[model samples]
Target chain A: MDRILYGDNQFFAVNHISDAKSMEQSMKFKENDAIIATLDQAIEAGIDTFMCTTHDRIAFVCDAVRSNPEKYKDFKIYPCMPYAHKYANAVTELGIQGTIKQYVPGNFFGSMFKGGKALVSKDYLAIMELLVDAEMKMFEGVKTPVVFLQNVITDLLLGLGMDEILKGFHDYVREKYDVEPGFITMNLPKLAETLEGLGIENPIICASINSANFRMSGGKELYEETLRTKKIRVIAMQVLGGGAIPPKEALGYVCGLPNIESILFGASSKRNIDNTVSTIHEFDSK
Target chain B: MLRVALVGAGKMGLSHLSILGAHPNVEVVGVCDTSLIVMGALKKYTKFPCYKKFTKMLDQEKPDAVFVAVPTKLHYEMIKELLDRKIHVFAEKPFCLNPEQGSELARLAEEHNLVNQVGYHNKFIGTFKEVKRIIESGALGEIYHFTGEAYGPVVTKKKDSTWRSNPADGGGCLMDYASHVIDLLNHLISPVASAEGTLLKSIYSQHVDDAVYSLLKLESGETGVLSVNWSDDTYRKMSTSVSITGTEGKIISDASELKVFVKKEGALDGYTKGWNVKYVTQLTDQVDFYLRGEEYSAQIDYFVNAALKKGPNDINTFKSAARTDNAIALIKNNSKTKA
Candidate 1:
């Protein structure tokens, strides 16, 4: 058995490494030995997943995998990249590998570095081609297949010509780049319609974990509808909203959702890790 | 007296042509575009003299003003060339790829002392202006925090490889959509101190952010969340809304609807008031601001007067445009964009 990805007993914090300084702090808890010590500790405590929210956290989390390479040969790490950063296989291989996807190119409106500018044009098709090409190049030379995590916002899409534009880009990728990237739908209803329109059959999970409870209520029903028509997968994120809510509440929320394969979580301190493992254990016992 | 020519017949150009074509004071001298197909269609549709090249059109027509409605990549060169000709200009939103270009445009316009404007039509929306009025009036009382939401269906093209997705060409949902929200935030809350957010979608391309959620902190200790995206299926739910929670009351405004929710004291408990929508069209601000004398003149009389008299009726400037550019920079700086 794959062991339930989420249960009443297992829970974790959704944390991102703030800076390089925090890396030192992370080492102390896991005992300056290897990165997986922490993962091992959490796993011993019954927690199954650890979500590193930023690229900065990847190295610290990956130290375990790098040190013991084979120990975690079976484990999966989900390191959150703001966007294109995850494409850097050098750093990403150490931790986890999930395609980090974002909309805005470069930093909002700053000057571009050489070979760093985005391919832009007035013709929407031209832009779509560039995006697909980049996706192809980014995913190149990767041992582990990546599932692009798309965190979409509802308000922004409608403000622009959403349907016509997204379809144009997606179609271009499918035709030109030959990649049908996976998306984590923040808005379930919209994602289903988008998938149906494109005739695409890939997994589409709920974005982040904070809204696990919200998705459980009606999102699961919507998830079912999409799955019935197409072949999209579903998952959850922000399970604890950065540890704001207690671990149990977060665990219960993800545990409650149907067909949820993964719930991404983050941790800042050892106590958080212990609490998360304990929460997972408690949920499992119940 | 103010000779003006247009270089495109697209929807926006047509809108401008309609207004300028019939104005009593302004002369609708010429229109140009490389697309003879679109030109012929437009001429048959709207009936205006069309040219293949703007330079040829400008040289033959000798208009005092020029409107560059071409693609984003073409903007810088065209505007610079026009400004070199000592002509005034008006461009559309996502002004340039970055703030530096916007500032350069502003500086060049100033160096030439030309009237420059950008089409941020949302700003002129009556509801937002009224909300601004209410905020300025101190009715909401001590503005605290705000959340602005602008979302709609995804945008694609008939053909592939269009400029909208190009990062260098002022493409992507962030520049195309969110910049409007950022501009509005700049207007409502001056000087964004810091901004941090994540781009959520790559549905369209790897280089662009289709969906983004950002937290902005103003220099005045006010915080706001601006969520802009091109990823939703509710096509008609296309709305721009602003919610402000103040010490005394709360004010909400979207597109053309503005409302205020206030706390009632002892005497006025349970009573609801001040939900006035101010029945006015959004375009009126631009119309009235630019064409004050005439009630319903298709042409902006002020643009003509400014051209003829060489005096002043130009309401927008480069500095104001630069502020928008800078705010967009702040947004990009704090973005978590790698893989």
Candidate 2:
């Protein structure tokens, strides 16, 4: 994992801190070319991995990366799966049956699985595979070395105690895509314990890690304790506490922590990207 | 542990189940749904008992509280059954097909001295809660006009048959999407006393309107515009927000963030005049189990805690949500008359 990873929240108008800033980002990155230009700047700023959600626009990004293979040779994308809206919108337009038929295909539609509830764990695993395939369709030719399960599903599975589904994702991604399966969640301590329980060792987990507890469930102390003790590759995001912390203070606190393999952040500008990269470098050097 | 049973194991049902399943004070005893396959999976996966019928699940489990996440139409009967059983209940939003049903359910719950709530999850959003606190604090004095909006890509295409395509099933931008915004306006600003100049436009779904626009008059003489559309594909997900203007300041807020511009800097704590902004992460208190957002679990937490109380419920209770339902009916009637 790269010590520094760039993110796509800014491209999609997802500023956890400010709506005004989000709108500004939306206007600035309204075009696919604009998005590509920002990525180029991230590359110049020395960020090789782009951690992004599978928003429909990410397809255009994938196409752009594919067309200019030489320019993006060293670049990689960490795809967060289920792109929930894809299924949400589909279910909105076509309901459950139609969504499964359109997305799941094959046995899911043809078998005695007409009743959505009738489909058992076997079908669920198949559906998970198919949906993962569908979500990964956007990254066809790009290099996605680590695929992530979005926190929504990760936390849901965690809450439901669906350990097998978590492992199912781990196994499917490792076996099928030949990539490491990562899980992003708000509750790092709980997930760490759960993964430990599942016998899934040293998992890759990206969560909110900052001086403030922020989105980290349990609390900041627990996250720090987990980081110190857990066997996991931790990609720290929301280190700024949704911009609550100053850049220097945020980076300083996170950089001082152990086992933080990468720090993920999103920026829609060259200046901000460069500043963030330089700040992280300064803290790491210290 | 508070014994809890769930009805309607659809998306929202399952979501609530997961969070409640993990709640420290809660034990999910049974889950009921019409979907055999959903039941089959629940039986196979989780330790909770699964049933196809709601009555049987409630009768067998004898839960202290029942979470009814069924469609809007099913809300009335199922919730009434729970209230009749003297069980504290939580139902999903856009409470019922009409205000009449909502009021009846509210009356039943009140008469039985039960804690009841509707899942207007936005009320638990810290940013929006801050908006309410700011407005009520008179930081934004003499609030005049506002606009409530929600636009998403839910019904971008013309559909064959779905819950979203049927008005009876609480399909439509107004019911499914706009209700969240309407409820926010009701709770944050004022209960909409009436509505006028309504325009329910169908951009995609033939059976139901995909967009709802209208002028709403709140009980406190505050006025606002309701603009909602589910056919807008620009947003990756449902985006709901409110922009309220007052003589002293103006506040614009969504699920993720809140922005306020005030004439005086010292008007509110943690907020400077001129301009101040806050995020969900900063404002929201952390929950033990967070699903999509803390608001989802927080809403359920509120309901579950309120369930243990003896008297009437508070915070998105049946009575409070009935106001939103009444507002929805006003908008619907106004739109129909003009159309």
> Pick by lDDT: which candidate is best?
2
| Second chain TM-score for model 2 | 0.97
* Residues B1-339 of candidate 1: C-alpha lDDT, one tens digit per residue: 567788755545654654565454567678887643345444443445668788888788888887666655677788888889889887766677667877888899888878787666555555666667667766666788998878765453222244666677777777777777777776765656777765556665666777768888888888988888765543223456678888877877765445667564431233265443322331132231111111222124444556566456433344565677777777787775553
**Cα TM-score of candidate 2:** 0.94
Candidate 2 lDDT over A96-213, as tens digits, reads: 6667778874565675654433666887888789989988987998999999999988988888777888999999999999999999998898899999999998999999998867
Per-model chain A TM: 0.52, 0.94
Task: Tell me what fraction of the real C-alpha contacts between chains A and B each candidate also makes.
Answer: 0.00, 0.66
**Local lDDT at B110 for model 2:** 90
Best by TM-score: 2
Residue A104 in model 2: lDDT: 73
lDDT of each: 0.54, 0.86
The positional error of residue A235 in candidate 1, measured at the CA in angstroms, is: 54
Give per-residue lDDT, candidate 1, residue B223: 90
For residue A144, model 2's alpha carbon misses the true position, in angstroms, by 3.0
Q: Name model 1 segments beyond 4 Å from true.
A: A1-286, B43-47, B156-160, B263-316, B337-339
lDDT of 1 at A235: 56
Q: What is the lDDT of residue A51 in candidate 2?
A: 95
Candidate 2 segments exceeding 4 Å error = A59-70, A105-108, A114-117, A137-142, B270-273, B310-312
